[model samples]
Every structure is written in C-alpha cells, then in structure tokens.
Target: MREEENIIVGISIGDLNGIGSEVVLKMFEDPRMLEFCTPVIFASIKTMSFVKNHFKLETQLHSINALDQIAPNKLNVLNCWKENVSIQFGKEDLKIGEYAIKSLSEATAALKDKTIDVLVTAPINKHNIQSDTFKFPGHTDYLNQELEGNSLMFMVTDTLRVGLLTDHVPVKDVASHITEELITSKIETVYQSLIQDFKISKPKIAVLGINPHTGDNGVIGSEDDTVMRPALQKIKESGKLVFGPYAADSFFGSNNYKSFDAVIASYHDQGLIPFKTLSFGQGVNYTAGLNRVRTSPDHGTAYEIAGKGVADLGSFEEAVFTAITIFKNRTEYNTLTKNSLAVSKRKRFNPKN
Candidate 1:
C-alpha cells in the first residue's frame, strides 16, 4: 500500500460549460479540503480562468506541467488540452464534450497508475457527449469500462447509504435484468465495500422488492418471490446480515430504511426517488467496488443556473468531503491490516525459531 501522505486526488472538471468548474472552484475556496488531501484538477488552465472570471471567484489556480509538482495550499491544474474552450455558461456544445472527455481520460489514467488516490468527477452532459469518440451513458458506465468494468453505483448521505441493483436502465426492462446472479453480485459488492472500504463490520443491507408489497407472495409479481427472495436467502445462509424485498412504497415511509446500514434498490428510481426526496440537495453518488475510489454530487449539470452563482453546492461539498473521508478510512484500514499481519508473522516465526 502507498503512504497516505502521498495521496493525490484527481478531479475531472465535468462540462466546461456547466457548473462542474464552479463546484470545483467553490470546493477549493474552502481551505479545509487542502488539509485532507491534495486535489489535482484534470482541466486546462484556460477553462478554469474563464470560470473564475465569469463567476468572479476569489480562488487561486496553479497550472502545473507535471504531477510531481502538485503541492499543498495550491490548486493543481493539469493542462490536458491546449485548446481555448469558449465559456457559454449553460449552453451545450461539442467542444465542451471534447474537453470533458479529455479531462476524464487523463484523470482516469493517473488513477490507474496510482498517482491519484481517489477521483471526484463533476456531472457531464449525456446528450452533448454522444459522439463516436465519447459514447458513454454516464460517468459510472464510462469509468466501469475504463477500469475494466468492475464497479457499482451507490448513493450515499451521512444518515443513509443505498446501492442500485441496476442503474440507468428503463423501468420496464429492470425486471428482465434482475437475475439471481446479478442481485447476488451487487449484494456482495455492496457488502464487501461496506466492510472493507467504509470499515463497517457486519453491515446490514436491505434489498427492495421489484414489485409492490414484495410481489405479495406471487400475487403481483413472481420475480420478487422467485428471483430476489431466493438470492437473498442464499446470501443470508452465508452468514451476512441482509434482509428485504420490502415494499418500496412503504420502506421509506415506515422508516424501515433506518434499521439497515445500506439499502439495495431494484432500479434507479426505486432507490433514487426516495433518497433524493430525503437528501435532495445534499446527496453524494459514490461508485463502489472500484479499484480506485470515486464519488460525484447527486445533482446534474444544472445548466440553467450555470453562471448565476446561485447554484447551491451542498451536494458537491458533501461529495468532496465523502471522498476525503473514504480515502482516509481506506488508507487507515490498509495500514492496520498490514501491521496486524506483520505482528502475527513475527510472533509465529519467533516461537518457531
């Protein structure tokens, strides 16, 4: 494991035209973020300058030629592209798409090389970036492919954490995708992440039902009875604390969600609708089961309020803080594990010798 002091966080400036730059700038303005980790923005200096001037922000920006030059109390800007991107505020353009993709690619490369400890991505426009060069549904799918496809999308807040069984899929097609293998895999990913990354021992997970009232014992839908129930039972047999197929409608209302550490929703809306209702302006989208830690604000590009300076950055703030916390926790967990193993080896070998 690498030393915690060397942890550099790579941040992708989402769409240059959107609030991505604004949030990134706003986060840097708070001096507290620097104390936790060094943040390296994978964006061109020109784009950041335009944002700062347009918003009249009082934050300092430093353009660096190499990753080794990154330091504390400085906003490290990695100039991945040399093109001068025009600032259109809320307008979407092909140029913004190109720039966003460029920043993400460079930051992803840095993460893969272990130069960056974690990644915090700003929201990107799905429609604008639909060209051949950039053909990803969203950041999660894009990062999944880039990192060899081992990842899960999990929404998190201080009080609640929820993982999706199937993300960005149509509601009608959601049931088709919910097989025994898929549910089991997602459950295991969420389980392992809670235990290993988040440092939760014996995390309790609540799995939501696909149909109403947990399919009512096959009266409404058998997918919950046949597919979800069986898989969850198998998981429980493994001694993991998992419960549910609970009615999505009543789960949040009854406050049953509070009993578990995390909830596994059947689809996007099944999980996000209630989560957003509860944590609308302060939710954090976390990508679990990845080789490198990644997080993003729950909100979108907010194109209408791009340059207004009225974009409430509560969610972005939470996302940034969550990334730092997770990074620190993981670093500490790895250190403790290493120390325990070393001590055990010494004790065993000393007695044998």
Candidate 2:
C-alpha cells in the first residue's frame, strides 16, 4: 500500500518506567514501517528522547503539534505532556503511572473521535496504572468500558487464534464467573469476529472446558456438563459452527486446535500459558467486538529488560500491523455490503430469465 493509503495508528505510551518507550522506538527505527502505516505516539517528546538517548538509537522525530501536519515518513510523537517526566527505568513511580494514564486518555479520546483509524497500546503495569481514575484490570477492560461493548481478548498468531472466556480473573474466582450467558455471548462475539474481523466465511471454533476432561461427564466438575455442553448445543442449534467443551490439556496437545479457526479457553492462564509458550513474541492481542480497532503485544512490560535495549519489538510491531490489516478489512467489508442485495440480484439474474 502507498503511504497516503496507510492507516493512522495511534499508540498509547504505557508505564514510562517500563519497556513501553523502548519497544515503541524500535518499531519505527526501521523507517520502512512508515510505508505501511502512519504512527502517532501519544507521549511526551521528552520520554522518547530519554529512551532514544539511553539506547543510542537513531531515528527522526516529528513532534505532532497539529494533526494535519503529520509526516508520512517521520516518527510522529504527539506531546501529551509539556515537561519531561523523570525516567525511573526499572522502578515503578506514581508520576510515571499518572503520565501513562494521560497518554491513554488522550489516545482513547482521539480513537473515539476518529482521529486515528486504529490503536496499538503498550503494556502497562496494571497495579501502578490503577487509581480512582483508572479502575480497571488492564487495557482490554478499560477500552471495553470506554467503548461500551462486549470485548473478547483475542490472542492471534499466524497459525492459531485463542479467545478468553474470562481474562484477568483469579483461578479461585473463575468458576463463579463462568456462566451460561457469559459463555454464549463470548462465543457469539468470537464467531462474529471470525467472520467480520478475520474474514473467515465459515469459521469453526473449539470451546475449552472449565475443568479437566470436560468434567469427565460430571465426575471431574459439573460446570462443563451443566453449563458449557448445554451452551455449546444451543450455539450449534442456532446455526454457528462451534464445537467442544473439550479438555484443555488435550485440545492443544492432541493437535485438535489446528482443526478449528479459533479456540475459546475458559480463563486467563488456561489460554495464555499455551499461546505464549507457542507463539510468544509473535503473538498479538486483539480486542474483538468493539466499534473501533485496538490491538496490543502479547507480552507485558518487562521491568528486567526495561532500558537494556534488549526489548524485542516483535509483538508490538505485529500489533500495529494487525490493527491496520483489520481496519482495512473492515472498510472493505463495509463497502462490499453497502449494495449487497442489488449485487446479489444482478449476479443471480440471467438473460434467459
């Protein structure tokens, strides 16, 4: 795609004391990334400067004072703050968390206003970035509240896609949260996203059971038999190509996940443990079923490797590219459906008739 046709990607600077700035800089370092999309980082220029200098990296910076002045080839850093915030690197600071929130809030506003086509959020320390203002588990939860929609944390890679039925919830609390309604709704959302977001015409899905061996037909646990199996039957009756309350342990191990387009894991660790183990740096977390496009890296803010310049940009860059691809695919799908009835009629109408 040409530079002008490239989608506008708005990035939120996560905890500055973490690897957010480092990874963001590394993504744009290649210069070729600009040809695919126009990136505008919602961060203080000072933060970018500090990270750049500390790593001794070379890249041109274009401070975004005005939206219309965005340069296609330059790294656009919209100054969310005027003064330079202190870089603590490995330490968590209140000032850093507050600053991260500012960037997120502004970027979110821009997203809602259509200032950017898509958003690529950096990883934030959930505990530090929390307050009365930000009372959510993480980015996915925060955006779901902001956008007022049922959001599925869809983890993606080239070969596999996994969506969480319940994310960021503890193992003890997970059973209580897994209800018939929740499972049905999330599966429907995943189905729609498979068709609309991923452009799969007929997507097959696998639903992992809450318990081992899928309750072993009611011996291991009852939720799988009482809740998930019934819900899966109802979903299938509704004409969706969904199957399983399969045992989580054997689903991936038996290579059953490859037969379906997507897998719905019961909780966080159940899904992410295997996904990260297999895809790791190549994975992208996409928020499905929202009105706007949003994606993030599969990994979190690595405090250990914060300013060491060893932070890999694999997931972050993939997140940006994935956002752009989804945005473009959505636009194309919308355009295709605009006159679908007439198009169908014309294709079906024959000269003999």
lDDT per prediction? 0.87, 0.87
The alpha-carbon deviation from the true structure for residue 333 of candidate 2, after best TM-score superposition, in angstroms, is 1.1
lDDT of 1 by residue, 1-353 (tens): 45665567789988877888898898788776677678899987887888888888887888987887787767889988777878788998987888888889999999888788889999899888778777778999988887853588899998899999999898889999999999999999999889767889889999999998888888998999889989999999999999988899989999999999999999999899999999978999999988778999998889999888888878988887788778888777778889999989999989875
For every model shown, what is its TM-score relative to the native structure? Answer: 0.94, 0.94
Cα lDDT over the full model 2: 0.87
Off by over 4 Å in 1: 339-353
Q: What lDDT tens digits, residue by residue, belong to model 2 across residues 128-162?
A: 88888788889998899888579999999878999
RMSD of each: 1.9, 2.6
